[model samples]
Target: MHIADLQRLITRDPGRPRLTWYGDDGERVELSGAVLHNWVNKTVNLLVEEFDAAPGTRVLLDLPPHWRAVVWALATWRTGATLVLPPTTEGSAVVGQEQDRGVADVDVVVTSHPTSWTGTSAQLVAVPLPALARRFDGDLPPGTIDAGSAVMTYGDQIGWVEEIDPTAIAVEPALRHEDLVTWALACTPRPTASEPRTLVGEDHPLVVLRRTLQALSLDGSVIVTSVASTTAFADEPERLDRLRATERITD
Candidate 1:
């Protein structure tokens, strides 16, 4: 049987809010399973149609722990592409320099940068945070495309595609689709049915991804706050309590 974690989750509960994000700049975003699934589908189409990403294609995801990053990761797997995570400290580097290291040995690189990239030899897709209304500044390299714009042109339903091998390497360290789903399920807490859980910490992609999946696996929602906001709440517990968060997962 084919294993598709995101697809299965969306199928199970399309209307439930699976992921919620709060940024330090007071930016907030919420994604229901259906909406997240649509983004993933569009991304998968972009990878397959524009980037020629097929099964086993190496895709380097060079972005912070934001909603867009999560969407790209799921889209990579859905398209049967191998997901390559950047180094832990890569997020701190300057944009151009960071792409040099992160894009190495990968067929495609999807990044969240403000400006267009003109360096990488690999297929580059720019996913600007707080997507701009105008085109990105600077000359884009050949094969570079704005992901924010491209995804909007694709269909929400991913058409016929090859079934993904459950045991295939989805991430490093022998992590497979089945393994990822199992880990997320294990991390999930028992359902309380009263209030959603809360996740607050640094922008770590793995932790954010896992926590989001954990909440979804139990048909529960989550409120993910920035580390700064979380720290502020530490001094004012009542403020955190006012959000009605049933549980708190911290770094």
Candidate 2:
């Protein structure tokens, strides 16, 4: 199913809770389907109508792992842009075997820092979360985005890539259950209860993980990709403890 289809489901059932944002203090903010849909709509309007973002246009997203990422990602997909994510914000040169899989080529870069653009030479724009928050009075921006386009990370810049043809993108109507089934089949190969160290790698383990969780009929699960360094020290016991403690609130 396309991202728009998923958004439509939420719009149809606005009260259904779909996302839970956890804080370091164990505080949580629940994003109900209806509320999330509205937020996405606002965000879509801001990006598309306000900024003139269109399908196949790349929009850089430099924000952290907030609920906004999820919403913006869905909106980008619906609009037909290929969403890009930078490996890190420190502006390190691409290195190691994992660099190839980190950031894909794109036309725009979104960064939190207005100065110091890094990584690619794409158009740079800063989406200051604080400024945005103040602008909206803590509410998400306004508008609905159609899938078929995507919002991805460029380098440290944020703007639009106009080379893509919006007319070529399409959104499948029934993607949820079908995607669930696909995820179930893919995640079944991993050892579920093993030490966390084994899970960290330059691999797409979550693809398989999603499949496994789906098979169990689990309604929700957070899959942490190995970007967290603590999992590498799982054998050290204390290190793993600290890492686990840090992530426990989200779990």
Candidate 3:
């Protein structure tokens, strides 16, 4: 089961909201399957046309656990590029630091920063968050690409791309396409027709990725919150009431 296959499955239900994200600052973002797929397609075209990304290409995903991160991950997988995550140190809450040396191993690095980055020798792709705000205030660095601006010019559909191998390495830490599909299927709970199954969790890559996959696998929707927000809403009764009042969460 390649990432492309999962995307195809979700795209069949284009009208339903597949992912809803809430930022720490009360920013709300909702993407239907078709919208998500359109972003993925643009990303694929950006990586391929600009960075010459192809099968076996290594892409360093240096972004936060925002919705755009999920878009990059799926785009990388769909392009058959190996997604290399930044190294994590034990007991450290921060991830995807710019100073990390892991970027040396990849061909291109995609980051969620407003300005250009000079931390790595690899080609840079700055993917600004918030989606709507101005990307950069000054001139971008040489050899750096602004994904936010470039993606808009690309076609919304991925046309004439090569077929991706399901056995290819999709992510670092030894996760393959087939493995991800199996895991998502196993973790996805059966959803009722009345309400969509929902998951709330901290804005960390691992948590966001897993929950997003599970929701997509079961044709459900998710609500993403920051760690601080999760801590603030820890009381069980209040949390339960809030979830119930929303009338959108099944789990």
Name the candidate that leads on TM-score: 3
How does each model score on TM-score?
0.78, 0.50, 0.82
Looking at model 3, the pairs that clash are none
Kindly list the per-residue Cα lDDT of model 1 for residues 138-235, writing each as its tens digit. 44566678776778899998866667777777776467866766776676444455434545344677776677666655556666776666676677
RMSD of each: 4.2, 10.5, 4.0
Residue-level lDDT for 38 in candidate 1: 83
Whole-model lDDT, model 2: 0.42
lDDT of all predictions, in order shown?
0.67, 0.42, 0.70
Total colliding residue pairs, candidate 3: 0
Predicted candidate 2 versus true structure: per-residue lDDT over 88-155, tens digit per residue: 54433432222364544444554444244443545554443321232212221122121212232122
Task: Please give the lDDT score for candidate 3.
Answer: 0.70
> Can you list the residue pairs that collide in candidate 1?
none
Q: Per-residue lDDT for 145 in model 3?
A: 79
- Looking at model 1, residue 203 earns an lDDT score of 62
Number of backbone collisions per candidate: 0, 39, 0
Candidate 2, residue 203: CA error in Å?
14
